[model samples]
Each structure stands twice: as C-alpha cells, then as structure tokens.
Target: MPLALYLLALAVFAMGTSEFMLAGLLPDLAADLGVTVGAAGTLTSAFAVGMAVGAPLMAALARAWPRRATLLGFTLTFAAAHAVGAVTASFPVLFATRIVAALANAGFLAVALTAAAALVPADRKGRALAVLLSGTTLATVAGVPGGSVLGTLLGWRAAFWAVAVLCLPAALGILTGVPADRGRRETSGGPALRVEFAQLTGVPLLRAMLLGALVNAATFAGFTFLAPVVTGPAGLGEWWVPVALVLFGAGSFAGVTVAGRLADRRPGSVLAVGGPLLLLGWPALALLAERPAVLLALVFVQGALSFALGATLITRVLYEAAAAPTLAGAYATAALNTGAATGPLIAAAALTTAAGVLGPLWTSGLLVAAALLTALPARAATTPGRNPEAAR
Candidate 1:
C-alpha cells in the first residue's frame, strides 16, 4: 500500500465525517433553528442531492486538469464549505453552506477513487479501492459517533467547527501527499461523456452494477429512516438509535474487509452471495429491532451484508469500466449517490401509507430481492478470458 493511499483515506475520513455528522446533530439543529425534525433531516438530503448532481458535472469539467490539482481543489472547497457551515446561524444560510460542502464532497470522492485506481497495479485494484473506501466505513463507526458526542458536549455549531479545523489537515495531506501526473488528457466535446455513458449503459455488467446500486439504495432508504420507525412504533429509546447505528457500522466494516478478499478471488460469487444475504437480513433486522438482543444481532448482519454487497458492486463497476476507468469511477459514484438520494425519498413515501416502519422495511426487502434477481443474469453473462474492458 502506498502512503498516498493512506493520505487519500484520511481525506475521505474527514469528508465522510463532515457529511454524516449532521445526522447525529439534527435534533439539536432543529431546536436551534426553530424547525421541525423532518425539516432538519433535509440538511442530509440537501447534501445527497448535491453529490448526485455535482459528481458527474465536476468530473466532466475536470477532465482536462491533472488529477492531483483537481483533487486538491476539491479538498479546499470541502474545507471552505465546512468552515462556512460552522459559523452560519441563519437556517437558509446554513443550508446553502451544506450544498456547497456536498458539492465539494462529491467532487473529492469521485477524484479520490480514480486516483486510488491509478496508484495501484490492475491485479491489486480491488484491495486499493477497498483501502480508500474504508475511510467511509471508519467514519460511520468512529467519526459520526465521536462527532455526535462532541456536538452534545460542545454544541452542534462547535461540532461543525471541529470538522472544519480537521479539514485543514486533510487538505494539507492531499496537497503534499498526492503525486502529480503531467499528462493532460482532454475529452473531445460532449462525445467523450456520451461515449462513456453509452459504454456503461451498453455493458451488461455495468447494468448489473447499476441495478445492484439501486437495490442497495432502496434498502438503505428504509434503513436510513429506521430511527424514526424504531422509536415511534418499536418503542425504542433514542439511546438505542446510536447503539443500532454503531452495530450497523461495525458490521459494515467487517463486510468490506471480507468482500475485498472475496472479490480478489471470485468477484462473481461474492456478488451472488452478498445480494441474497442482504435481502434475507433485512426482514430479520426489521423484526428484531423490537428485541434488544435480536435487534443487535440482526442489525449487525444487515450492516455487514449490505457493505459486503457494496464492496462487490464497487469492484464489479471497476472491472466493467476498465475501458474508460476514469469515467467508470465517476459513474460508480454518481450511481451510488443517485441511490442515496432515491432511497430516503422512497422510504418516506412508504412510511406515509403503511401502518408503521414495516412498510418501508418490506419495500426495502423487495428492492434487495430484485437486485439479487438481476445479479443472476449478470453472473451468467461473464465470459472466460474476456478482456475486462470489453465488458465495459
């Protein structure tokens, strides 16, 4: 592993913390801003929307620049956005800050993944990408929890301030650690974007990757809204919320680690098993949320399986996009962000009609099932000695 990969991971840790820490402080933010909890939750949605829209746009626009410079610029933007967010008192102003921050976040992640791929041997790519993405898992386990504690202790505003300060170090790490590439590869007109899009859409493997992402998104949508569901109907306490989240994060970390190894050995098999396991785990998770021990056990499995599938899907995309790897990396980020944006919205609608959280959980389970079904066709299409790029 390169030292640069570690630095990139650190930057990802800070970015993930800044993006997700808001969830832990939502109630506090709502109270401080005199808004409802539903409204406060939009802060997170706002960031997701930014990522969904900004990632592809930024990637397209930065095609001509050196990868190092693009990454550095995005990291600086991330730090600046967080700094502004920390100081703002007005609700609208803070929202705008979040949007800017998310844009920066999206661009940084898109570039970081591409850079990670560029830094390693093709055979070792899955492991390199896993190391970079681990920062995100670590954020869920450590950064969000720590930020929540800090927000409670120092005030929500202070939490943002801490993230802002950390960004300075993250920015410095990127600037100093990432290697410079002199090659300036320019895409020809809109054709480059169109070509990549066509390749991704045309490839069966890529389609499967997108389907996997969509299914994952749908399940996550329900899971994301789990706190309200568990607390309102399951009769769980707010404290239990963090416990479940922590358990979920722990499972996710384990899954990512395991999936990386599996992908190296049998990428197709990992995708096959992971998708079904995720589908199976959700129902158990929903049912068990009512029982402390059962809920903890189920949630852990749910998190682990979800993350393992996530890792598998990521490696699958990289393999599919090997022809236009940079564009593929950007598309993978875009597809996942699209899922992130879509999942919560779908869950919110389901929660409206159904009696309780069960509706969303069932809906999420079905999505996972659909994703699993799609994988069968995907697996069958794999050809022996097929140059991976042709699959793209």
Candidate 2:
C-alpha cells in the first residue's frame, strides 16, 4: 500500500469519528437539547440520510475533478461542518450541521475508496478497501471511546471540537500526501448519471448492496443503543461505557484486519462464515447483555463479526461491478448509509416497546439473517455474463 492509501485511511478516521461520536454522546445531547433520547437519536439518522443522498450526487457532480482535489475539498467542508456543530445550541441547527458533515463525509469516503482501489491491482481491491476501512474500525477503537471520555469530562460540544481539530490534520494529509495523479483516472467520457444508475441497479449489484445495507443495519441497531444497554441491563455505570466501547472497537479492528487478509483470496468464503457468525453473535449478545461478566465478551464478538462481514460485502460488490468500479464504490457507500440511517430508527422504535434494551438484538439478528439470504447469490453474480441470470 502507498502512503496515500494510509492518508486516505486517516481521512476516514476523522470522518468516522464524527459519524460515530454521536452514539456515545446521545444522552448528553438529549439532555442539553431538551429532547427525548429517541429524538436525539434522530441526529444519527440525519447524518446517514445525508450520506445516502449526498454521496452519489456529489460524486456525479465532481466526477470531472481531480481525485486529490475532490478529497481535499470534501475534507475541508467536513471540518467546517464540525466547527458549526460545535457552536450550535439549537437542536435543529445541530441537526443541520450533521447533514452537512455527512454530505462531506460521504463524498470523501466514496472518492477515497475509488482512489484506494485504483492504486492497487484488480486482485487486491479487497485488501485495499479493507485497509482503507481499517481507519473506520480504528476510529471506533480510538475515536468513539476518546469522544465518550471527552463528552463525559468536558461536554458533548467538546467532542465535536475534538473531531474538528482532528479533521484539520486529515485535510492537510490529503492535500500534501496524495499525489496529483495518484491513482487518478480519466472521467471525461465516463457514463452519465442515469447510465451509471442503470448499471448499478443490476440484480447482482443490488443484491450485494442490499446485503451491505442489511448487515450494516444490524450492526447499528445494536450499536446505536449500546450505551444504555451497558448501563442498564449490563450492570455497568456511566464510566464503564467508554470501556465497553473500547472493547467493541478493539474487536472490530481485529476482525477487519483478519478479513482484509482473507477477502481478496476468498471473498465468498469470508462471507459464508462472517454473515452467519454475525447472526449468531447477536442472540448471544441478547442473552448475555444482562450478565455483566459475559455481556462484554459477546459485545466484542458481535463487533468483530459485523465488521468482518462488512469487508466481505465491499469486496463482493466491487467484484460484481467491475465494469464501473468508481460508481459502484460510491453506490456501495450509499447503500451502507441507507442502512445506517434506518437501523437507529428501528432500534429506537424497539426501545419504545416492551423489548426494551434487548429489542435491538432481535431486530439486528433478523436483519443479519436477511442479509445472509441476500448475499448468497452474490458469488454467482461475480462471474461475467451470469449476474442477471444468477440473481433469479
């Protein structure tokens, strides 16, 4: 991997921190904004919706621009959005900033994946994407826990300021680290938006994307409510929330690391094992969440399995859409965010019911099972000329 790829990972780390810090800050945010915790959670959905809507549109509009410039522009915009978020007192204003930040976040991720994929051989796109996404996993390990501590010690706004400070260096990294032509590809005569949409909407790609969405939804459903789950049934206090988050993040990092090595070699096999394991892990989490001794252990397992499946999903999508890898990568980003947006809503609704804290476990489990079914046909789709027929 080139230095530029790692720099792209750094950019992802900053964005990922911004994206996930809200999870740990939800209680503080709800209290500060005078909103219900469920309502406060909508801020997360807002960000995901923005990413789902903005990534492809931004990618299309900026397709003609140089990759390095596009990445730099988005990173600066993201940093500015965080600054706006840090100062906002009104809930609506804060919500708006999340949308703005997510837009930039989506664009940066889509372009970063394209750049990373372009830098490597076709055979290594899986590893390339995994390495790029490792930054996201690392953010969970470092950024989320760090943000939790910052939020606990200072305030929720301080976490935003911290993310803002982190972004400046990420922006500088992209501007100075990535070469002008580093993995740059000509986009002058690329497929138009409608054409790209038609290509991406193919059955194979759609199934792969749906699988991505479902699996991501499952991960977020559990993760979105994790703070409360730990404090309530898991028998941990507020101080231990960061510790739980750290354990989850550590597992995610390890999962992605191992998946990266295996994804390029046998993506189908990775998915075969990873997806089902995620399904199994959730029930285990649901069962163990009330037992403090075992709950943390299950959280780590679920976290690792969720991310491992994610790496395989990305690899499968890229393989299925080799004809238009850039757009495919962008669409994949959109798909994942679509799930990220929906998962919290589902988990929030579950919280309202008698299922309480454990509801997300069941919700996530069903989604993971659905994801597995959707993913099953993807291997056949990877074969040239078989995608359309195999999906049937």
Candidate 3:
C-alpha cells in the first residue's frame, strides 16, 4: 500500500478508536457518572444519532470543498469533541460532546470513503476501501481493549483523554500526508440537494444499501451488549470480556479481508453468503452464550460474519451507485449511522422485558432476517455486472 493510504488508515484508526471506546467503558462510565448502565449505553446511541445526522449534512455543506480539506476539517472536529468529552464533569455535557464527536466521525468517514476511492484506480476500489476500513476493525481488536483496560485502571475519563490525545497526531498526519483533490461538482441551486436525494431514492441499489445498514444495525444490537452478556449470564469475568472482544475483533479482520476478496470475485454471491451466515450465527450466538468455550468460538464467527456483511454491502453500494459514487457513499454512511443509532436502542428495549441476554440476541436475529429479505429485492433489481477492474 502507498504511504498516503497508510496515513489515512492511521487517521481512521484514531477515529474508529474514539467512536467505539464507549462500548468497553460503559460499565465504568455508568459507575462514575452516577447513571444506570442503560443510560450509559445511550452515549453510544447519541453518537450514532449524531453520525446519522452529520454525514449527509456535512457532505451537502462540503460538497464544493476539496476532499482533503473536508477530511482534515472533520478530523479536527473529531479531535476537539474528544478533548471536550475528556474534561466534562456534567453528564449532559459529555453527551453533547459525544454527539459532536460522532458528527465529526460521521463526516470524516464519508469524506474518507470518497477520498479512498479517488486515491486508487477504479478496479482497486474495494481493496482500497477494505484497507481504509481496517482501521475501524483494528480499533475493535486493539484500541477498544486498551481503552477498556485504561478506563478500568485510570477511570473512564482517561480513556476519553487518550482518544483526545491521539487526535493531535492524527490531525498532523492528515495535514502532512493526505493529497489534495479538486472540489466535487455541486448541483446548481436549491433544487440540487432535492435532486440528489431524489436520485438516491429512485435507485433500487440505494434501497439495498439501506437494507444492508438495517442488517448491520440489527446485528450490533446484540453485539453492543456483548460485554454484559459475557460477564453476566455467560459467567465470564471482566478480564475475560476483553478477551472475547479481541476474539471478535480478530474475526472481523479476517471477515473484512475475505469479503473484499470475495466482492472482487463475485459481489452478489458474497452478499448471499453473508446474509445467511449472519442469520445462522445470531441464534448460535444466543445458544453459545451459556458455554464459555462455545461462546468464544461463536463470538469469532459472529464478528466475522457481521463485518463480512458490512464490507460486502459497502462494495455493492459503490458498484450500484456508480453514477453518483460520492453521494452514494454518503448515503451508505447514513444507513450505517442510522443502524448504529437503532441497534442499541432496540437492544436496550429488549433487555428490559425479555428473558436474559437471549432476548436481545433473538430480537436482533429476527431483525437481521427481515434485513436479509430486503436484499432479495436488491439482488433482483441490480444484478452484478462484469467489473474485472474491481478484482484488481
């Protein structure tokens, strides 16, 4: 890979770490902030909501700016949000900071996808995106675990501080390493945004992208509560929880790589495989939660399948939205953020009335099934055409 790509990946690593650290720190945060664990989970939901709202809004506003400038500005915003979050004593303030951080994160990722596509040749887009997205997966494997450990030992505030600290270098890296690109062609007048929105809506492929997002959200609903599920009913210690997360993260890394390769070879087939695997894995995840050894194995499978689905869906969206790739990418980000926001809320609701951890997992599985059904229309509507370049 090129050095620029590596730097972008590093920036992504920082961003991803900042975004996901909340999940691991939820228990510690709840205790420190004097809120219920359920409330602490809302921090993640808040960030997701911010991301959902920010991606398109930022994209629309920044439509005429150079891609490099947009990316750098978003990174700066991400850094600032983390810094504020680190120092805030008030819970509401912290929540607001999370929203700011999430918005920046959402914008950063949307721009980054567009930048990554521009960085590489058309044929190599999938691989390039995979490399960029690997940063998020790496955060899951290393950053989240480290953040959790740091928060446990030093207080959850320290974790946020660490994320804030990393932002400085990330900003510097972006300034130094990211290449400048010409501004995107903006649509003329007030009708432009409406036209773009209408174009996206009219596309069957975009609907598939949204469905993909829903599936991803449904899976996360269960996964977000993973620490509790493992540490509580599953009878694992806190120390063991991070280990399970590491296993899941490792699986995600493999899944993403495989998905990229498969997407290059056969996009539709990869999507088909991912949907069934996800549907099958959730029930298995529920069953395996009772057995430590089995649960460990299942966690790996769940992470792999879930992330595989995500990567495949992204590649499909890129392909199908070829006419308006940048806008399509923004739409994809929107779907994902929407899912991120929905997952935790849904899981939290299920946890209230349903039997143990099984409730959330079962509910998530059913939702994923519905998402899978949405893909059928997508597949029928947008058949994968030859793209030999994608294989490259």
The TM-scores of all predictions, comma-separated, are 0.89, 0.95, 0.93
lDDT value, candidate 1, whole model: 0.71
- Please write out the lDDT profile of model 1 over residues 69-173, one tens digit for every residue: 788788888878877877878889888988898888887787777778777766667788789878877877788767777776777888788777777887788
Better of 1 and 3 by lDDT: 3
Report lDDT (Cα) of residue 291, candidate 2: 93
> Which lDDT value does model 2 have at 114?
76
User: Could you tell me how far off, in angstroms, the CA of residue 28 lies in candidate 1 after the best superposition?
Assistant: 2.8
RMSD (Cα, Å) of candidate 3?
Answer: 2.7
- Which of candidates 2 and 3 reaches a greater lDDT? 2
Across residues 320-346, which tens digit of lDDT does each residue of candidate 3 receive? 665564565677777787888888888
Q: What stretches of model 2 exceed 4 Å from their correct place? A: 183-185, 376-392
Q: What is the total number of backbone clashes in candidate 1?
A: 0
Q: In candidate 3, what residue range of length 10 has the lowest lDDT sum?
A: 182-191
List the lowest-lDDT window of 10 residues for candidate 1. 383-392
Q: Please give the distance, in angstroms, between residue 306's alpha carbon in candidate 3 and its true position after superposition.
A: 0.5
Clashing pairs for model 3 are 123-389
User: Where does model 3 exceed 4 Å of error?
Assistant: 181-195, 381-383, 386-392
lDDT of 2 by residue, 1-392 (tens): 88999999998998988887777899998999899988988898999999999878887777777888899899989989989989988999999999999999988888887778778877777778888998999999999999999999999999999998998898898889999965455665565566777777678788777888888889888888899988998888988888888888888888888888877666666677777788888888888788986988887888898888777777667666666755766887888899999999998898888888788778899899888776565556423332422311
